[model samples]
Target: MGQAAPSKDEVARRLADIGPGEEREIGEGVFMTMHRLQAIQPLGDGWHRAQSTEGSFSVELPLPFNDFRVRAQATDNVEMRTHTVGGKTPGLLAWSASCLARRDGKLGPEARAPGSDKIEVKGTPPVAHSRSVDLDDMTCILIVEAQGSDPVPPEADRLRFLHSLKRTGRPAW
Candidate 1:
């Protein structure tokens, strides 16, 4: 049988083991290949969560090479973001090209924001590259997005979810 892909828990462990400004290779030739990951940490009010990560990766194969940073929050649910900065050239064409190259799985149509950007998913398998966001500052493009995903223990509704789970010693499911 083929080698099994690394699990997110394994990824989290590797990430947590890394120092704030360190990097690790979770997967080769993949987005996780050239990464230097920090731990998945808590933002605020969320106690169960340990940390979040911020780092970049590069692909130097196929046709268009790209360099981008990845940020993600992993709990019972996983949420992530990618910002591409270098590659072919500047302008929408480059952004689109990189974004297209970095398509993971499509965001559920129902959840897609009104003006979510279009991406191409042909180059790598599911999530080959990272998404690109156009910004003017250039210095602060890796801003974190809001988190609203339904976690396993259901951190979304933290008050009841956290309280009940702690007492019951069971997931809110």
Candidate 2:
């Protein structure tokens, strides 16, 4: 009845349009691939938004997968909210730390905190970030953390993103 399931290599692979630094560079050393992951500004007092400039990623992962991203550009700069393509969902949770930890390749200040800061999160996925990007803030550090060997749900990944930019949201799961 259903079509033959796509192979891990198939579903995991990024679209052809996904370039080395534009979108999903599905392979090793991914930070160099997912560069536009964070190129936006604050929307409200606490909401950051990024359009699907290169389009959103929909890799078929195992568990409650990470759906999309929320920039969390500003808390006071905006309305202190998470603005994904679906605005804000009821089950959308948030992270308490930055996904830019050394574990993900960048130098994040986790020594001040206790948690691994790797941010192994879980919960329903978010919508999409946005369609317009702000290249001035060419911060693509989250790419590695998002597409790394470890398994951090997209829901949790988004949370960490929001928190780092001082955005706010309650934990869903």
- Runs in model 2 deviating more than 4 A are 1-5, 14-35, 52-173
Task: Give me the runs in candidate 1 sitting further than 4 Å from their true place.
Answer: 31-81, 84-173
What tens digits encode model 1's per-residue C-alpha lDDT throughout 1-173? 53575798976666554543344655432333222222222334432231111222221111133333443332323333443322222222221112211122323223333233222233322222223332211111111111133111222332231121111111110
Instruction: Find the number of clashing residue pairs for candidate 1.
Output: 8
Cα misplacement distance, residue 95 of candidate 1 (Å): 22
Assess each prediction's global lDDT (C-alpha) against the native: 0.28, 0.29
Question: Local error of candidate 2 at 97, Å?
Answer: 24
TM-score of each: 0.25, 0.20
Please give the lDDT score for candidate 1. 0.28
lDDT of candidate 2 over 12-114, digit per residue (tens): 5654445323434233323223333223345454444433222221111111212232232131232111122222223333212112212222222222322
Best by TM-score: 1
Count the clashes in each prediction.
8, 21
Pick out the ten consecutive residues of candidate 1 with the lowest summed lDDT.
164-173
